[model samples]
Every structure is written in C-alpha cells, then in structure tokens.
Target: MSKLACAAEAGMLPGMFKRVVVFWALLVGAGWSAGLPLSPKEVVVVYNANQPDSKKLAEVYRDARNIPQDHLIGLELSAEQDISYDEYQKTLVAPLRKTFDDRAWWKRSKNPEGLIIPVQNEIRVVVLMRGVPLRIKPSPLPEGVKVDPKDPIGGRTESAVDSELAIFGIDGLPVQGALKNQYFQSKKSIREANLPFLMLTARIDAASESTCERMIQDAVEAEKTGLWGRAYIDIANKFPQGDNWLEAIAKKNLEIGIPTVVDRFNDTLPLNYPMTDASIYYGWYDWNVSGPFLNGKFYFKKGAVAIHLHSFSAEQLRNPSKNWSAGLLERGAAVTVGNVYEPYLHLTHWFDVLHDRLLDGNSWVEACWMAMPVTSWQGVVLGDPLYRPFLHLNGDGKMLAEDKDYLLLRSAAMRWGNDPEEFNKQLGMAAERLKSGTVSEALGLDLLAAGKDTQAAVWFRNAKEHFEKAEDKLRQDLHLIAIDRKAGRKAAAVQEIREAQARYGPMPEAKALAGWLDILEPPAPPKALPK
Candidate 1:
C-alpha cells in the first residue's frame, strides 16, 4: 500500500493527512533528517567553482548525504579567505538569488507590511563548502556617516560569510552590526515557525580536505552509536551569566544521565588535565586553544562535539593549531560552533540552549541558530548541519556497557524523576550492577549538589576504581578532598593531595593535584632572612 494509504489506515484526521503525508514523503529518503523538519531537498549546496576542492567537497557531501542533483550551486569566487562586501553581493548573493528565482526553489509573497518575503520557502538551508570565503571584509563607511558612541556594534560591518548568507532572503538590512535571529530560543522547527527571512547555514570545512571528509564521516558515525561518553564542562566562572550558562548545562547533563565533569576553576582547564572519554566539551574565555587540549597525545572521542568560547575563535578557518574551532576539529572533534569576529557574549551562541536543542533532537544547524541571539554577525556552525548528537536517547537497551549505562540511568531518572529518593536508589543500584564509572560519577555529582558530600564521596570512590586512567582517579581524589575541605579537614585534603602528587608522579594529570595543594596549603614566604 502507498504511504498515503498507510497514513489513512493509521487514522490520520481528514484535514491533516495530506500535510502529514507530504511531510513524511519529504523525509522518506533523507538519511540525516529523520526527525528534523529539514530534508536534503530543502538544502542548497554552494561552492567555489574556481577551486577544484570547493566543488569536489560539495559533491562529496552531496553523495554522502544523498542530496538532490540540482541542489548544488557552484559559483566563481575569490580564492582569498576574506572577500570584499561588494564581491560577496555580486558574485555570491546575486547569483544565488537568480538561481533560486530561475529554479523556483521558493515563492515570493507580500507580508502584512508589504515587505517581499518567501511565503513558501522550499530551500531552508544553505551549505557552504570548504573553499568558499570565510569572512566578508568590512567596507568603508560613507564620507558623511558618523559613528554613534552608544551603539557599540554599529561600527563593525564585517561578518562571517556563512552568517551573511543565512539572511540572504531579507531586504534592506543594515550592513553594520547584527540583526536579531528570529529563531533564537524558538520552541518550534524552522518550518513550523514559518521563518522565511532566515536560512540555516553551516560549513563543512577544515584545515585539510582529509579532515573535512573525516568530519563528515564522523558526524554520520556519531548518529549511529550515539554521542556517548562523559561531558567535560570547564566553567571559567568569569561572570554570573557565563557561569550560569555552564551551571545550567551541568544540571541538564545530570538530569539526562550523561556523566559530566565540571571544572569550576576561574582559569581555563590547566595543561594536560586528563580529560578522557570527552564526547561533549564546553568551555570559555580562552583565546587560543590551550590547556588539556594542548597535550599532543590528547584527542576527544570519535564524533565528539566541543566548543571553546572566544571572540575570534574562528578568526582563521584553515589553521588547525591556531584557534579553538579548527584545532578541536583537527584533534578529532566532529562538530563545533564559533564566531568569526568579535560578537558580544550575550549575542553569541547560547551554549546551554544549543545543548538543550540538540538533546531535544534538533539538527545541528537548527540548534545552532536557535542558540544564537543574532545572526548576519559572526557565528559559524562547523560540521554536518544535520548531525543529531543525542539521537541515541531514543535507543533500545542493548549497547556497550558504557553506552548502555547512559540509557539505563536515563530510564531510571524518567521513571522516578518526581521522587529523588527513588531516583538515587535506582542510580545507586545501577552503578553497582553496571560497574560504570560514568554512572557512578553522575550519581556522585548529583548527590554532591544535594549537599550529601559523604554519599557523593562514596560514589566518587567507586567511580575511581572503575576508571582506568590515572587522571580519572585523581579527579575522584579532588572530589574526595573537596568534601574533606568542606568538613574542615584541610589538613586531610592537603595530605591526600601530597600523596596523590607523589603517586601520580610527574604526569600531566599531577598538575591538577598540585593546584589543589596550593589552595589547601600555602607555602611559607621566604624568611625575612635579609631583614
């Protein structure tokens, strides 16, 4: 029987069946868009026709994702990283507009304000390939124009090329500053929200062609097994806003049953902090990629999604070792988002919102735009836009012990969510049976948050035993010592640190212990020997 018949047989209401069936048909062959409103048919791939790698990358993505043949739009463009604004309009935007009109990818209509807008936009996403220009250089202002002191962002006319492309449908927008994203914090999908002025944009780009290909493959692989492993959240604790963003993220992770490690240190995570099994990482305020990631031996888990917040985090896209985004990509992160220029903290991607959206099964691009307060400014989503990292939340109970533990804990939390006592009891029993360090650490963090430090310490200890890495155990040591320090056992905390410092030896993980030691025991100042 036809799918329409199936829908009818499934008891779809008379008025909604056609709409639902048509939507289902659009999703029938779209691989990465199962639950997302977007389909490959809605995506238009833009590439640099002048560059062999540009067009090649577009084809690679198209074949991999089974995008439609006519969706690929290659244009002659500059080989430089930064393009003039005029060139961006003439060579890129104008040509794209022409293509959309000629091909009837969308229908134009007048809004209530008589503004021309796409009433039925079939093309909702634009995928810019690697060789396309990364940023648009700010053009000179007119001779008579004067800057306003109160408008901080008005002076900045530069924007990420991808970000600029996202709003190509809009008319008469100012060149300076950013426009508020219509989809920011939106509870509905782009289609459902009828967001016609905006087109979700993403770049499948990296320092090298091989890395880009790997990124595409990794995103696909991640959706299969699920984005599994512990989350590493480095709280810069700079301001309440930034700190709260991270704190809420930690709370959400705990609620979801993902094992999370949160570093509350003001300074970015120190060098070689032994961050293992990191599938999701969010940290901030570091300019260049440093700290644990600096270790040559360290790399995140396959399909890991990491983002290190910085103003110019994506200043240059082709240098893997220079900034946070590319560096993480080269070091095995599948997806990351960043700003190409200086965007104020609040205007940047709301990391917590992105986390929630992804967990709620939104695609990467949708979640990214939903996370940002503004666009046509400087944010870029790097990786397959359709990657749904937490799609595994809809899984059967049969997975690896580590992966399965996440499922089991989430189930327990859902079943007894209203009863904290029952929730903890189920978690404790699962930790014992599964022998999962991730589950134990999750429970420990939850208990610690509830002010049950003693119980938290027990689980921390249990987690330490299950974990094989020395740094993992040392993290548990820090947890235990923190509990001791709270109980006015500073001396015991210091003693444990001293022993751990010696036991762990000169390994990079020992650096974290030494830091705690200094906090607990300040070394004596040089005696006033001269005095």
Candidate 2:
C-alpha cells in the first residue's frame, strides 16, 4: 500500500483500545506481525475566524491537500473587546492555550508510536488579522489632524466594520491598545516554545498614506518582541513606491534586529502600464535598486537571509517570441543578473501549464528543471530549437560534428545566419549532440561569448557532473565548487573548498572561496535583544 493510504487507514482505525485489541489478536493468530510504517502527517492550518478571508485561506489548505472537510478546523476570536493591553493578554491566554492543547492532541494522534515529532512540521498557522488596521499608531491625534470623516477611519471602534484598518488591527485607543498587548503575549508564548508562525498583515485602507507608517511601527514592535520569524505585507498594487515603503520597513526591522519580509506580487500588478516587453518588464534598473536589499546591504543592513520573488504569470516576463514564454526561470535569471540577488522565484505559471497544457502540461517539477537552463542564464541562442537551420556543409565538405574545434564556429554562424535553412541545420546538429562532451565545451564557449558569468557557472556545473561520472574527480571537484560558490551556496561551497584544500594542498581559488564564505556567514544569533 502507498504511504498515504497507510496513513489514512491508521487515522481511520478506532481508538487506542481497539487498536491494541487488534494488535493482540494479530500477534496471537499470526505469531508475529510487523508494525506499519508511519505515514507522513498532513499539515494542520489555523486561521482566525473573524476575518472574511479567514475561510478562504483555510480553504486553500484543504483544497491543496484535498482533505475531507472535517479535517480542517477554524478558530474564531471575538474582536469586540475593548480593554487595556494587559487585560487583553489575560483574555486571549486562556483560549490560545486551549487551541495549543487541541493542536498538540491532533499531532499526537498522528503518531501511533508516540514519538515526539515537532508540531510545526505538521501544523501551519495562518493568523488573519481581523478588524485590525494594516498599520498601527499611537492615538490622540495631533492638532488639526482629523481622521477622515468620509472614510470613517474609526467607526468600527465598537464592532467589526468593513474598513481596511479592521483588516489588520483593531480601532480606537482601547481596541488598538488591547491588540498590542495580545500580540506580544501571543508572540511570547509561541517563541518561548520555538514555534514557527506566519503573520499576514493586511488592511482595508491599504492605499491610505498613514498605513505605511503603521506597518513600519508594527514591524518594529514585532521585531522587539521576537513574535514572528517572517512578516508578509499584502497591499493593493505593485507600485514602485510600495517597494520603497517595504524597503524602508525592512531597514527599520534590521536596525532593531528583526527579519522583515515583503510579499511582493501577492496582489495585482502595480504598474499603470502593460508589462509585455521584456526590456520594460525585466529592466535592470528596478533590479539595480532592489538587488542590494536582497544582499542585506541596501537601505537598512540586517542579516536577512532571503527574499521571495513571486510572479503570477509568464506574461510577466514579456517575451515577444511565440515559441518560448519568458517564465520565472528567465525572469529569475534576469533579476539575479541585474540585481545580483538570488531570491526564490514563486512561479504561478505551473497552474496555467497544468490546466491549459500551455507548456505541454509538464508538472511544475519538470517545468522547473526545463527552466533551469534558462535560470542558469544560458542565452536562448544555444537552447532554442529555432536556430537549427544554420548547419550547412562547409567548403571543406565536413559535417559540423566531425571536428570539435568547429563547434563554436558553427554555433556563431547559426547565431548570425540570415537564412532559416542554415539556422535550422546548425541548430539541429547542436541539439542532436547536446550530450556530447564537445557540445558541452561548445556551450561553455557560447556562454563566454555572451559574457554571462552566471551561465558560465551553470556550464561549469554540467561539465563537472559529466566529468565526475567518468571518474574525473579533480576536474569535477574544481567546477562543482566554483558553481556552488557562484550560486549562493556559500556555506556548501566553503565545505568544498576545505575538502579541496585537504586533498590538493592550498589552491589559490580554494583559499579565496574559503575567505569569501567566512565573510558571508551571518553573525551568531544575538545574545541579547538590542537596546
């Protein structure tokens, strides 16, 4: 039986008593019965009930897993109470404790052997901020500072209202005060146990000018309390100004020692114009500004480890070509090149690929690997099939593949060839010999021709992998470490460097990689919170 089926059966089995009785009977009748291997437990998703989006978010978990409705649980919290921060803490502790207890039980039931597996591995909590503003601030408005009356910015002071502020935090001094207290208390409880939590802070009044300040303040508070490891800011559009705002908050969080995250691309595209041109959409200028942020050096320097680059459509890549769409692989490569940041690209194109067969309905995994060629920044000239027409008989009357030295010459001719037949012939020969060592060498040269450092790293990796399989350890070791270092695997690359040093004595490149890794590792976790 499959592992999932076994898990489902185990879950469907009766209580402990019944299971024990069956085990006893099996033991008596069959003399010995092997214990079943445990199934990988399903993830438990929790969201606040009060938020309208709460159900939708919870549904995402269920729909993703296709689990029975009963498997999902929703916890609803009352947003009506107006109390001091301390009182709010007292009010939430009891219910939160109950939820924790229930979660523990659910986790325990999944493990028939009673092994103490981490609940986080099986439980994911999506804390929806209901009736909370996207941003928070100290009340008692400054003179002449009126909360917009038409907006009724504070109308939901007593009951939950359909205001954007209510989307993230509560209204009025008391409700807002209560939420702050609850937030810290809950954070303390979760962090004390070293639990992971995801906070999606959204506001109804997302476009309002004051929202940015509140987001910044809240981030500062969260960092101070160690409440969340990751923070997601969801806004209406993709404004460059919005990115600037996030950069500012990321800066502030770093100063106070907080790991702040900005969830770009969660909403619609922010730009007013259509992003259908590769030059316009994946321009290097925007990346030049954002790249430093990824390297932990831009506006505010914090030892931030990673950032997420999400793209909902391949259309976001904006390739005019009909044969190949500019997908995450292309965009990611471009972003990495332009900005020198290696952020994970969340490709939403797989959904379209699966449903529409736009890209042969290849699973996301296959798509990712196919895109790896692009991600490695190898230009389309080498990989695209359209260039196959250029391989014609030379004056000396020799097929291009007959001589290794001629590969680059042939590729160059194909790249610059005017006639479709000549391009296709050359491309065909190159494509046919893709796995040949000569072809690999030719690809490396092509990358050099393109002056793509990142693509050189990829070629190095491919060459190393092939050479290693043929027992060429020295060449394999050299190229693998080089590629790893170039691709942000600094620590892994360092390990390879150390191995090389031990194996071959002090090599210059190995020593350099070691030094670079030493500089790249983040400082040890802070001993005490920043003053």
Q: Which candidate gets the maximum TM-score versus the true structure?
A: 1
User: Over all chains combined, what TM-score does candidate 2 have?
Assistant: 0.24
Candidate 2 differs from the real structure by a C-alpha RMSD in angstroms, to one decimal, of 24.7
Top model by lDDT, which number? 1
The 10-residue segment of model 2 with minimum total lDDT is 381-390
In candidate 1, list every pair of residues with a backbone clash: none
Q: Which regions of candidate 1 are displaced past 4 Å?
A: 1-36, 109-116, 143-146, 482-491, 515-531
Model 1 weakest 10-residue run by lDDT: 25-34
TM-score, each model? 0.87, 0.24
